[model samples]
Target: MSTTTTAPATGTAGLPLADRTSGLVGSVIDSSTSLLAKQTHDIVRFAMGSPAADAIPTAALAEVARTALGVDRADAFDYAATEGDLPLREALVDMLADTTDATALDRVTITSGGMQGLDLACKLFVDPGDVVAVESPTYTNGSATALSYQADLLEIPVDEHGMDVEDLRGQAERTGKTPTVIYTVPTFQNPSGASLSLDRRHRLLALAREWGAVVIDDDPYGMLRFAGDPVPSLHELAAGDPLVFSVRTFSKIIAPGLRVGWVDTDPSLQPLLISAKQAMDTCTNLPAQRLVEGFLRGGYLAEHLARTRTAYRERKEAMQEALTEHFGGMARWTDPDGGFFLWITFDSPENNTEIDAAIDTEALFEVALAHGVAYIPGNAFSPSRRFPDALRVCFATTPPARIHEGVARLRRAVDELAGAAV
Candidate 1:
């Protein structure tokens, strides 16, 4: 049975909330936006995972907007097809022809964004109390979406190669239950910035097939590769397998505020996807769809991606250098070839018994903010609050100089915390 909520009476102080809403956990990642907005300090923001302020092609978008939403075309403002705008869909199919995630016309369905894609996947597959496998240090919002559907989460451990598939199989077997949905960011994962290796990707698919589960391939950052060789996407390897449901977005590669994304599924499932979408928001915003269509058709994305890749590469290197200079032996971090994040954790001494090296990152958040730096605590990424000593820092949004400043501030924050502890 679907859990539903009733709205409170207009004059009432409190309303009856829904049972499903109890699991509606908010995103710490998004909360930082409002938190930072009120600050009067000159903070070096490393909190939000976004493109650098100068990275957005404002001039190009503004130029396109004139024609994409021209006064001459009244239909530009009308309701689009639930599947997607026809022109945008066609352009997308052509645009992805040489990419790792190429798909046919029938398999494409436009969505509001990648978040809605995850929600749709859960709504279509997840049942109340069904096991849903997720990475331990997964994107909290994705796991929260599953939780909202009342699904029981099985937190699989993640490493440099992404989710440990062998461990997942063993854990699932021991539980005597199979997961209905397996969610993965796959390439350049959010928070951790780890890509699933090819071997593990194949293994994950095998397990999902054996268990009759759907693979929610939520890859928003695959195309932003500034380093390393390309790993084939789960959608490509699946090769028309209906079990793989791929969610992609222009939010990362283009502008996030646009909120335009698409889901690539088996052709047979397109109708269901359309129906599911129709019952949600009627249709995605038409003007945004048209703008993206203009961008793609004008041959601007390739140049835009190339330019940003170079900038992001420089930014990532800056963050790594800053970490080495400031953090040194006190902490360790992941060196991602692409994507926007670097996961940092404190190094604990082997002989130390009285004090664990793990600083409570959650407790340190306020201190870091006061010191004019910010990062999402590792516990925010985990549903079970694991890794209290770690946090995620975004390098894509800040410049090289600001990155150094932020890390220095973070180091000072740690010193302040230590001083207070003493």
Candidate 2:
């Protein structure tokens, strides 16, 4: 698993890049923001899993920014403690006191975002060639982080109940290599919107225990649940086990631009997290921390979540209804209680292989974009290009009317692509 880099034969600059640079695979998800920004079309963007435009508490945030980041509070602009700003940490701890992911101040380290939390986890645990089990069609950024650390990724299957824990065991048995880390987005998973069942959750914990593996539980959408009973977070279920590292973010629940999130791990790991963070970005952005602190201190999150959950539930239902009307038997999608996405797989009664060939999501992306609609190709979610016939649609962004329009545009694009193929 050794990676070596050779300098370009003809390049005159003669700058030598580290071998690790080869492993720095970029995120298609993040790249879409730039790709979409450059386009001039009246596109219904279903690519980025951002909260709806109307869902963002802009006016409230502006007010918080004005007050919290004012010159009177000039200290907000200063460098923060590597652990995080104290006010934000205190607010977060108070905010999560009654929740399943509640933790003590010592265990919580505010991060730039959930992605940094993932990066930190990899930095702390992964070694070159270490086995890391990632859900098939997992979050690209999460998997990419592991790859950047030179971890040998094992893509595990995911069904309606989330990652197949039983299959994970079988795969480990077959490969004869125990995974050093099991990275999962267990609840309302990013692209799939599937929650791991309580039974499988227990099994995964047991397997991690046997393998002595760390579980990187990345749950950004847990609090936006609009339906179904709440499942305990991996951190809650682990009961302070050092093996469970939980990453939470305000990106999905509040605002992504704020880029504020936190990690909950064993108290012993906090010192290491601080040291690691110091060498990385020095500190999480201070002004953003103050803004988040202001938002939390003003008690805005509860009402915000209530409004967001209701809106997103309606949006999810709208997306499903549109898919039913347009796709019907042509495709199937996951029904998530809450989250920004629903994973769709193209299918047909004619033949599986033929239909899949007829509809390549990677190819369809351009067609859909040209037709004033956009979605993330299924292949982008998989490192092995496993779901070329699948795609992820974010249901939390557009309204019901726009959702229908976008689906109609997508259907037209699909038809055009299929016709052109013939």
Candidate 3:
């Protein structure tokens, strides 16, 4: 079941209720645009033509609801600390310690999600129009949020290992005023599906120090690693010396609806973030925090993560095989160690469409939708680059069977373009 509301005539314009909003929302049709509504059509999910619905762990969710309800529901209903309720904060501290420095406690703020956690970086560090170094094709949400704060988003190229350190150092030299922060997704990046090598991680932190800039490490997909040993978080590697905030999220692992995430960084920004947080939803839902805390305590999280890992790994395998079987010789994609995405890069010769056409790139988005499938184009994820033939396919939502069907449809679409060129 999906919710529905009348689409506003001028959504972004904010016209008077009585007046017609003739303003164009062309942004949604712009390849550079990032709209959660377009990216996630919760209002009309049935039109998506994908799986029935993501099966949430209802039993565990029920447990969480009941636990929070039972534990002084009146207090849980009250406003919580801007830093998040002390108990949830403590729980985060305990959970995050396994990944980073435990005693480096001064640098933790409970954010709504990795998205808000990243937004806090701009609020505290970046001034309007200030440049911020970002990996080319980093998460759009990060870039979009940065744009909202009026920062100049800089792009650094990424290889299989992740953000290029030499290019970053060169960019720093060119700017002379190192961006406020350098951001990267390190492991299991969004579209490229690349992970920063351990050496690159060390190199990045050192470059940030050299340029006198902070490192805004936004790593929501770190935990979903289906295979491979966990790398030390950027904060853990920096030893809390440089101004860095390691952002983590429980979305992919548990549920995005919960929106439980945290950022660990220097205490200098805490007061500012507390203020920004107050204006934005007043410390997140307190009762929600209590419920998530209960969920963590029940020991179901471990099993839940295990199940997610297994399921996603299988989905990844299915997508990988489909690409190989259906588009094998014609397409190339990076194999991720632990994440929900696989990026398909068609051979250049096979790509004839002049993506630079004045026409909005997002127009092609409707092509896939018409094909009874929906996916984010690569350009939206990487506005700073000419990555036209690339597309990101999420394996988290669709089941294995549909993964093949969707890829088959995509292959046909690509072939149609190739045939036109001939």
Candidate 4:
């Protein structure tokens, strides 16, 4: 009566695989969500770039869903247009009309999410061995998408003002090659929480024009500005330039679970985008698109953004205050005007010179997890395994008090690691 269990196949020993598989680097930031989910203990999560639970307009969404996906609305559950549901596309155009990312319906193609938009852009423009420039601490998913297309990534360093355009030029010069695709988060960049300066934006466009490179402007947080003056999006700056491919998502503003986003490309590329999307998913989830359309048409986004912006600003301040209180002498962090993350780098304090040189944030991750704190190690954001001394902390999901607790736990983890090294 005893049953023998067979071990599942391991590794890709005999399976036919393409060379592109080698470039399929996975995302540690996303894997952390799965890793943390299995833990039974209470962990103060500062890892995922997600909106707070309260930030999601659940009740409003539920009300919208009642109509958007009601039994009477049988078409709501049907497949959407490859370009996008017409109503949703119209709504999106209207929603963005007054914003820095304003766009036309002719250029919009609904995507599964921001990640899909990134993938689509790579699929369209990136050829095998093509040079792709990305920020040093870029969005893991974005860089991974480019890598999946067999792109040769050149990591450009980012400062408080965002991707260093001068360094980008210097690196291209050093390598004697220009990028085929320049991928940038630009506004409130992921991991670094830095926006590309106005001066740099112009320079980047000029460089792209000179190099004939396609600029993948992946901007998911441009509308979340809370602390600083608004900056024009690359989409806005390009002003109908076909070289700029703008990817946007409702995940940050609305809810990630909806998985609804869109790409604003040239009208000439719209047909190709539809073909690409049809080969992939046929179309975006119809119910989700309907829900987003309802949310947008009901005039709920403005109020929701205003409320969340205020809350995020307060949370960012709280996180900074906590960092100052605990690691004031031992660390430095970025001050983002409006975004979900703060980039923290361990520095050489006068009293603790060993910290900057010895402690590796990658190694400290396990210790931090045990201490009931979770943050993405800076190395996870880089393709070249750079930033061993730094990490990215997300303050958007956690409340002020929880943020304080999480920062304290992070400090304890650092102390534990520092003491172990000593």
Q: Give the alpha carbon lDDT tens digit for every residue of 1-422 in model 4.
A: 00111222434787766777777777788888899999888899999999999999998899999988988999998877899999999999999998888888899999999999999999999999999999999999998899899899999999988899899999999998789999999999998999999999999999999899999999999898998888899999999999999999999999999999999999999888989999999999999999999999999999999999999999999999999899887788999999799999887545554364456888889899999999988888888788887899999999999999999998888889887877
Sort by TM-score, best first. Answer: 4, 2, 1, 3
Instruction: Quantify all predictions' global Cα lDDT against the true fold.
Output: 0.88, 0.90, 0.68, 0.90
TM-score of each: 0.95, 0.96, 0.84, 0.96
Clashing pairs in 4: none
In terms of lDDT, model 3 sits at 0.68
lDDT tens readout by residue for model 3, 1-422 = 01111235643476464322221112222232333245553221112111124536768878778858675678888888888877877776666565544534556777787777877777777777778888887676676666666677778988888998898878777877567778788878876768888899999888778778888887777777787777777767888674677787777666777777888877877787889888886787776788777777777777877787787788889889888887765557888887767777666553524221222223434545555455666665664545665666777777788878887776555555444445
Q: For model 1, where is the 10-residue window of minimal lDDT?
A: 1-10
lDDT of 1 at 295: 94
In model 1, which regions exceed 4 Å deviation?
1-14, 349-357
What clash count does candidate 1 reach?
0
Model 3 residue 319 CA deviation (Å) reads 0.6
How far off is residue 53 in model 3, in Å?
Answer: 5.2
Candidate 2 lDDT over 233-346, as tens digits, reads 999999999999999999998889988999999999999999999999999999999989999998898999999999999999999999999988688899998888999999
